[model samples]
Target: MIMRQAWLSSQVLSRVEPNGQAASVWRFFAGALFPIQLGSRGVRRIKNIAYGPEGRKHLLDIYLPKGPATAPMPVLLHVHGGGWIVGSKHQQAQPLIQYMASQGWLVIDINYRLAPWNRMPVMIQDVIRAVAWTKANITSYNGDPDFVALTGGSAGGHLVALAALASNVDGLRPELGDADCTVDACIPVYGLYDLLDQNQAMEVGVGEIRSFMTRFVMPKSYSEDAALWEKISPINHISPSAPPMLILHGQHDSLADLESAKAFAESLSRISKNKVTFVDLPGQQHAYDCAYSPPAPEHARAVHRFLESVRKDKQR
Candidate 1:
């Protein structure tokens, strides 16, 4: 009964907007469930470290494992998803980050510039900058610079996939200086692989594609130059030199179509020299791993196994 009450209180507190009503409710439950620490213990957090000159938008949070530093641990850089419009490093992937840190890995959750204001390649550039920063400075935090892995969901998934497949492309790293921007493995969860296909498949005379293009995707329409859409799509960049990837998608992801993710994984498995594993979660939604959902722990275990496999292969 007490646990149920606490859960209800948390739900209420999360939705209550600032005004008099929320304040009254918060005061009433202040002593009951005010301080909530859902993250795992024994994980040291270094918050709000700048990765680039873009101020807060370029800041990141690092999670280090507990105990003495014996050797450098492998790194997992997490990016959050909000349709390239809204999201923060602190919100999404807390459960996954805490779990990974508890198991002795240096985790980095980063915030990148959003769309409608930053556009397509700029967001990718921010991710590249974050990787460059991690490579250069993660040693001080006891992270292995050479064995970095990338993961994220939705828009974040797209960025991570792009960063992995398009590593060290001259155009993406124009101002970030010369830094080894390669990742050992990538796990892009529920990402859109082909922007051109996505746009073209939209129903004719529908304003959704036009609205998405003008508002978030890019200022230029797909009609302007179809090749530009292909250029930005990760599916078009798959190569023999690309790193191992585990593409995870929900069976019913309404936002970023499940078929697209499956097709992307199939292409990667066929063309890329690296190992490609695809997991289709039954009855799962887009951000299923974000909270204490049923599949969160199971997915975390799967991720742990994948990371271990990648690490073993890297050592060989």
Candidate 2:
């Protein structure tokens, strides 16, 4: 009973607004139990550099290794997710990004325009533009432009997935003019695969989710633009040409249903010629990486292994 209660409390407390009584209560206890760490000995943080069409929101943080590398390091592009409305580069997966940096990998944590102001494809375009910027400029940071990997939770997962699969779609970033946005590998944690909800798998908070998407994120309703909805969904764009993907979804995720992840993995396995790995973690919840706990570090190590394995494959 204590375990169940703690688990429930952890999930509820994570969502509480900052500075509120509930959040204060949570921080008072959680602050000591699992202290957050965003830096390591060999990692260097370079903050708030504008990556593109230089608006306030069009920015990213680059984490580099302080130690000299024999050759250019691999790159990992992290996209933050907050239901398409909220979240930032600094708030999500700081430990994982720092760990990657410590391991001699260049990590780019990006911020994209949110909904209600920027609208749909703009968020997608912003991330793609970040990729273009990375490919062109990451060499200066001792990163190999050709070995780019993508990772994020929730909305970030969705964006990175589309960033890899749907890069060829129109209106993403016309200004780049052949700025290759193709990622070599992708790791989407607890991502929503089918935004159209064609299978009606999103039984939890269906109404609010649909209303928010149609009103803010989408230029038109699914009924009005079925083709467009189909195109943006990552699952629909699955092909043999897609980059290697490691899809991680929590089996007990309260936000993104596990069904979507299973379906996404099945689709990729069936169609994509590249490698596909899906891990259904038991007793885990959405955005668990927001804090650095047991499984968070474990998963981060797994991701590093996967990235290194991909690097080895390409080298051969």
Candidate 3:
């Protein structure tokens, strides 16, 4: 019962509004258990940087590593998942950004407009714009613009995967008129790849997918926009030029499911010559990395190993 209560409290804490209340909650949580929970070196150089137009869902936070800014570090651009309806980068992705910074990678966690307020292409645009912004200005944060990687979990993972899949799509190209927006690698954790399949699965309470469809795109039911669903689904777009990918899915995640990860890997391997690694995490669920109060040894080791392998491949 205590654990259940704590889980409910965590969800409530996530919904607490106002910047002050949010900060207070962050501080309270950070102080109580986080200090002793993880070994990551917390750096305060993180700051929110807006990339899109004025108003909502136009910002991102860049977490800079505490070290000399002389050499460019590999960049990780993360998107947070709230079923595409509700979420804040400050809450969902801050700790992960901090951890990446501690690992010597500059991290940028993006905030894109959710559904009802915005539509399908708009969120995609927001993500691509964030990529463009990072590619153009991340050097200031000691991040190598040329080596940018995209990552996220659940809905965020879908966006990351979509961004990676759309890297070569002429329509999805950013209007920044700057350097290329291509990412060097991808890490999508428990991301929904097939929107239609996910929507169908969510009918049985697989996740909040039914709501995501309503919030994120025009028309509540995915059936209304069959073509659009196909257009935006990451599983539909795979090519040989697609960036190398590392997909991690928990076996216990009924939300995103392990099949999606396997399907993505199979698609990449069969259709694209790019490297695709699938890590099947045992007995874990979606958003397992969001446990800011405790350490996730399995996730950490898997991610560390994948990053190392990708870095080595980059060196070659």
Candidate 4:
């Protein structure tokens, strides 16, 4: 741990644009380390709301602030990260959900079908369905449906980014015909950006994804379905209207490629008119925000600030 902190002190630097929200290594270590703070005391958790027809996988939890609000609060729809295989709505999101809930934000934590049993598009479809449900019903929970923001780490990150940026993507299911997947903003942490790897340029950690995805995640062989792989890659779907995004990837992340993550943020910054902030968290592992520590608390606070900015923008 000491070595990790020392290495981090030398390696981490945040890259952001338009707003200049750089992740300073000094900033990273400046905050005193805190214990793993889970849920916030200020929030009320209403669990197991079915967001879809599927049984447990389609259920979500509503983390609403306990007190009455001045108006409908901004909504945060979280898709948990576990590559594409293992994770749940509550998996690894406790710190963020608790903190955001305390901030008077209405947070929707959701679970989706994993791969092997469920293939590609099913996960994305589940995300879309959840968004549809949020849009249709969030008002009852004192959530402003108009300002829904999507966030997640790793696989969750990929899904949120795809659902927000890929506006032209056809609704994968017949039931989702005309279901709007638009979101006001997104924050993808240590997310896989370009899964296609056409250039074969992705670094080491990505090689494992190619094999793993082909076996359980992808419906067909890579040779037989390169296009689908490209289709699901979030970097492949960037458009001019991508929601404001803050991309955070660990400098030491082996699961999500760092260079590709940087490129993804840079690409979004180039194409989208919305603000894009990218932070290279030093010495932090992937899914660092799931814990309570320097970068985690600092970054979560940053996300809250970003969501606040997005909410204010939506109101105007």
Candidate 5:
């Protein structure tokens, strides 16, 4: 157990260092250590399946339980978060994905077009495309397409929330086929929900929000058109028909403030007819479950239980 924790720490440090030169070495060691510890957990991984035309950015990785089953397993479509600027389907959510797959679930981690290049709606479109692809083709991999759930942390949490709340919205689907992209349940961990609120809370004359918006989110600044920010925010789109949701946020999160998550949950509970469960991790920071720690496994178990409850409810 001690050795495993050491390797996990090394793995996290390798990927998080600011220095570009040392990153590769840490990544090498992290990569080498992970499989030895996890060993796919009796699951088979299918890599680099294309979901869109964005070349590498549109690709996703799938983890399927080994051997045959009497029935198709529930699917978890995971979106990664990098503040909409940078992030990959790989590396993030390793513990959650592996543990879920080990417990007889089909887990898919996806990548989408980044900002300053892809922009708003495009990132969401890529996610919709990935969902469409999964619904259409996952049966071949022994996954039950109809029982798909969405999960991600940070920016990923935001995207999944938007995808769930705005499911099948014509403006978002656009060129994508007429497939039902609705998920059975959604889990958004430490996600940013209200962009406009975030902008309003920013200190006067601070260009951080403006800089991020201009470069990654949209060409028009939030100040130029504040209403547009609300239009794109997931919190503003919630409805009674939206799927059941599980929100996980750390009390100590620096990014994606906890109060925002609480407010969002309150709104959802008041408005939505479905169940909304919020778990507040004490003393936990952003992306707390990403690393190997006591909290990581405990959160994973919470996720498993939540997913199972949703699945059972759907079965009835």
Candidate 6:
């Protein structure tokens, strides 16, 4: 009996129940049960760090493992997805951030400005700003700034890819010397790649994503600007210098097509001649990894495997 925080309104509940207290029966759960051991460790450092120029206070929740200062640990910056319209770093992301850090990676969960109030490049800029923030301060948290990687799901995934590709974009302005800021790799889960494709996909009832798209760009319509779409879309910006990319998608994903990941991986292969792994988890859907207890949950397991490989590669 969990009411959906996003949609819960006593006014709407009035129709079903004369008494407001009855609304609690329909409570919405963010995901399944989150296992404590696979989640946050009390032994970690929790930092409410800030970054971004103009003294903009973009807060980051950092989880640093208890370890020696002599070593540099890899970092994963996680962006939460609420279709870019609604969500926070504290909720949907806590489970994964906790889990990844428990596996020995320093995890940084960042919050960016949402849509309607902000749009397009701004969202991407926010993520870059967070990465910059991490580069400058992660060492204090026992994290190797040079070994940072990107990971997120859905809109979060889009931002993850965007941050990696836009590293050279003039505006982000990282305080850390540029060397520590570049991403070593990326792991995007069920990401939306093409706006035009997403728009078309929505027409087929998959368009629930329009809420997030419209949120990122508040112009009332995407039809007005063709270049803006191309400028913000991550799929078009692939380069030979791009880092290794591992994209995971559900074969049954209705919101974003698995084909988008395939296309991105193909582009990465053609441009960078680097490793680009695309995994299509059978019988899964978008954000399947978020499940507290997944049926098969291959998506979450795959992420652990990918991170292990990245660690091995780093050691080599």
Question: Which candidate has the top score in lDDT?
Answer: 2
Please, what are the lDDT tens digits per residue for candidate 4 over residues 1-316? 8446533532333223224555555535543454455466688899999999899999999998887899888899999988788988777767678878888889999989998899998898888889889998999988988889999999999988887877447644326667676889998888988886643557775668888898889898779987778888888878888899988887788778888888788878999988888878667677767765565555666678777877677778
Off by over 4 Å in 1: 1-37, 198-210
lDDT of 3: 0.68
Steric clash pairs (candidate 1): none
What's model 1's TM-score? 0.84
How many steric overlaps does candidate 3 have? 1
Candidate 5 similarity to native, TM-score: 0.84
Indicate which candidate wins on TM-score: 4
Model 1, span 205-276: residue lDDT tens:
235644685667675777775665666689878898889998887765677777767877887888889889
* Candidate 5 minimal-lDDT segment of 10 residues: 14-23
C-alpha TM-scores of all predictions: 0.84, 0.87, 0.79, 0.88, 0.84, 0.76
Q: What range of 10 consecutive residues in model 2 has the weakest lDDT sum?
A: 14-23
Whole-model lDDT values for every prediction: 0.77, 0.79, 0.68, 0.78, 0.77, 0.64
List model 5 lDDT by residue over 97-128, tens digit each: 88899899999999998887767778887888
Task: Write the residue-wise lDDT of candidate 2 on 174-280 in tens digits.
Answer: 47887798999999989888776665666566566668789888888979987777777888888999998888877678988788677788888888988898877
Q: Which residue segments of model 3 deviate by more than 4 Å?
A: 1-42, 93-95, 170-174, 177-179, 198-216, 219-224, 293-295
| lDDT at position 238, candidate 5 | 86
Instruction: lDDT for model 6, please.
Output: 0.64
Instruction: Give stretches of model 2 more than 4 Å off.
Output: 1-32, 199-208
Residue 253 in model 4: lDDT: 81
Candidate 4: give the clashing pairs.
Answer: 14-23
Which has the higher lDDT value, candidate number 2 or candidate number 5? 2
User: Which residue pairs of candidate 5 clash?
Assistant: none
